[model samples]
Target: MFRLVVFVASLAVATTTAAHFPWLYVADDSEPRLFFGEGLDHREYHLPDAVAGAEVWQEAIDAPALRLEMEPLEEEGFLGLAASQQIEPRGFLRTTIDYGNYHGSRLIYDAQHFPAENPEAWPEPVLAPEGLSATLRVEGDQLVVVILHSGAKPLTGAKVTLSNAEGGPGLSAATDDNGSTRFSRAAMIDGLNGLMVMHVDKRATGEISGKGYASTTRILTATFNYRSREAAKVSALQPLPQAVASFGAAVSEGQLYVYGGHIGQAHDHSRENLSGYFGRISLDGGGWESLPAGPPLQGLPLVAHEGQLYRVGGLDARNASGEEEDLHSVDQFARFDPGTGRWTDLQPLPGPRSSHNAAVLNGILYVVGGWALAGDSDGEWQAGAIAYDLCSTDAAWITLPEPPFKRRALAVSHVDGQLAVLCGMTEEAQLSKQVFFYNPASRSWSEGPDFPGSAFGGFGLSAWNLDGKLYAGGMEGVLYRLAEDRSEWEKVDEFQTKRFFHQLVPDGRGGLFAVAGASPTAGHTGSIERLDLVFAAPTARR
Candidate 1:
């Protein structure tokens, strides 16, 4: 008699029989036939002599009886079912069979049909598939692969392998009890890093937050499979002309331009904050050179827009009107012409702000959260956002909605078509890991993924987009990579030291320019470094 037993949580029993692990298969035709025990589940479902019983049921919208009857089989290693009527287009089949010596060895299966048109139209799974899954992520020049089971349980002692996407030899890792294991990205192949979990344990299951991935209903399979086709690694590049920190830097005409800031030994703050120097570094290996100087400014927002380098507000403690003329902040605005070597003043900002971040798109510039000086109270960060369109003749600062939260010293860059704001200091003076993406077309702000490792930003906030990938590093001394297609940031490589206040510009030659910055012990380093691209290739193919 057909029966449905109550599911007791504590009595949950899993099966990963080394002898027979059943799998269901279907043809690639419009009207396909079903089969069992063929591909990876080779030894799982061997047909037994005098078969006990096999039954099939399909999810349906309109059916008299969803249960199915078996057709007489001439095939040796296949299971066939004859349904009475049409099945739902988005439907799947659930099967149970007894064909082994093990008592009560009933296997349940939920297999989805391919060629699904819409995700919303897909039917829910009748039974969950028990398998392995993993993700290969960039972690400090290493590719760490996190492994999990079908129920989001981490599998310890599981054997995993990585190979070229097309097919080749591979690398192996035995998972730890925490279900955590790592691989090196520098050893990964150029194409896709194809990963497969080789664990065969049935008693492994764990609780996981459902937010990370959608239900594996449509993509259900007996074995877990994943691919991180594109990965990144950071390496040392060229050093800077001199040790500079807390300065204004920008990239124009494939060159990096800098403004005044503190020039100290390493990451030391003892350096004088009074320099009116300006310089630029060429991509042709010409190195750094002095440019016409402007008003000594530091902690100012700079950007390259419409062939002109523009400067936003700044903090002016180094002014020479005696010490009394020093101001905590100023609402100054100007644009520099590299040709004439002069800056033309423009309308000042809506307010006095510094240590902020900005991005330019289509001749319009957007400046986000930053700290503002108060006459009496300590400077507090502001949530205000403003924009200006230089393309318009009567362009004026326009106020927009507040950003994700109040913060300052952030790395903001334009990626793919969105403005991504990352790193910063929170109100509590903690490293901020919140990521926000602003869509210009929709005029909307959405939350992105938090950085993989630690929070970063502050006076050290510096980042840029190059080679179709967003590269961010500083303060935290860890270089992060985020491609347009990825929602989360990956820890690609680590800097030589705990550096901050550095400038990052794409070299356009498959590398990046690491300008001067400050390190904890090094004080200030004029040592500019270049990070060439690195990748992991397959050691052997299996």
Candidate 2:
């Protein structure tokens, strides 16, 4: 009876051990022993499994259902079961021989253990491709690789390797004596996307003595589109020379004619050498052309009456005593015909004088305030203004009202038969701002508006009838326009440069052509500039 009890106790202990430790079959011949802890509820029993098999069959049941297989009347301890053909129940054991143990044995299913399903919890590290430098640029349609070496001597016969983004075919070249290699028309993918990569390698001699080094490997990736190509077009006009003569002159037919007054050499000296030169610029030929030396006169003032140009009295050359003298002691006048291009003597001014102003009104030439004698040292400037009617077969000078101011170099222009004398220099050689008007019908002088600025020596004063308004320019290039009532002077546009002793000729296109002014600094310049006369729109009175 004690022996029987020992056998039963051993059987119970063996069954409990088998329930805690299940046999895991990797293959038919391979069975790995495994322990089932608190959470382990299933065991996979694989069939026809080799040691290297990837998968296994599994069967899960309650721990109490495990059974121990043993011989009759045998005491059961821990059993190490092995595959054997003589084992009953087809190599599997159960507690009962009914459908419960059979159904549990057939519960086997496949379970795969492939690298633990690659742990989806952690992120993997990605490395950029190796073997290239970073300095690269797009040249034309290719990726241009430039390697700068740190050396004093030029690199020669050094090899360079270039590779594309993919580990595909690469190119190699030898550096020239300049340590540079050029790859022309090489195909490269557009760098707009982040997929493209380039590699460059270069070998160069170092600046240190006898040491040769290669450039660090460079890697380049495409980041942006290349710049587009541009086509190639002409380049504005140059400036013209400044004026060198007088202003307030006239242009008739095709010739721009200027007359009267000497442009002083400098402010330190006077410009009293009234032996002035007459100049003409040909509009058709496009330049200034002066006539050969003509008869010397004082003031050298000119007026156009009936297609004839009349030059009035002016001083001859300076005398031995360094004083100006009247050479041809007559109120000498010379007439030039545009058709004949010749000069004929005309009846001179009634009085001999220099520094007088002239204007033609109704076929008559008016001459005003100049020195009476050739060498008058007594401040003998006259206010007497006179007129010569060319309509008379024998045109002779007739006296009119005197000018309001004793001045010289005063520019005069005729508008609607009215003579307008602008600013001029006083006998003291100071600029005068006073202006005067003379009505040919009334034969009287009246005060006009004051000039805007002080007039200087070499005043190239000019006046023109532009849209029924009188426009004038002075020595300092200040242009002024008189209002319709002639009561006020309005400053207009100034010239680009200071113009004195220049001729302002009516352009006949509602503009004036300025020509030949002596620059105070640059001396004589024969440049011509045009001034377009613009009329203002009429405004209502306030």
User: Which candidate's TM-score is highest?
Assistant: 1
lDDT of 2 at 113: 13
Q: In candidate 2, how many Å is residue 270 off?
A: 12
TM-score of each: 0.52, 0.48
lDDT of 1 at 527: 49
- Per-residue lDDT over 402-445 for candidate 1, one digit per residue giving the tens place of the 0 to 100 score: 77687787778877788888768777788777778888888888
Cα RMSD (Å) per model?
21.8, 42.0
Q: Candidate 1's C-alpha lDDT?
A: 0.55
lDDT of 2 by residue, 135-156 (tens): 2333334444333232233334
Worst 10 residues of 2 by lDDT: 230-239
Residue 313 of candidate 2: its Cα lDDT?
72
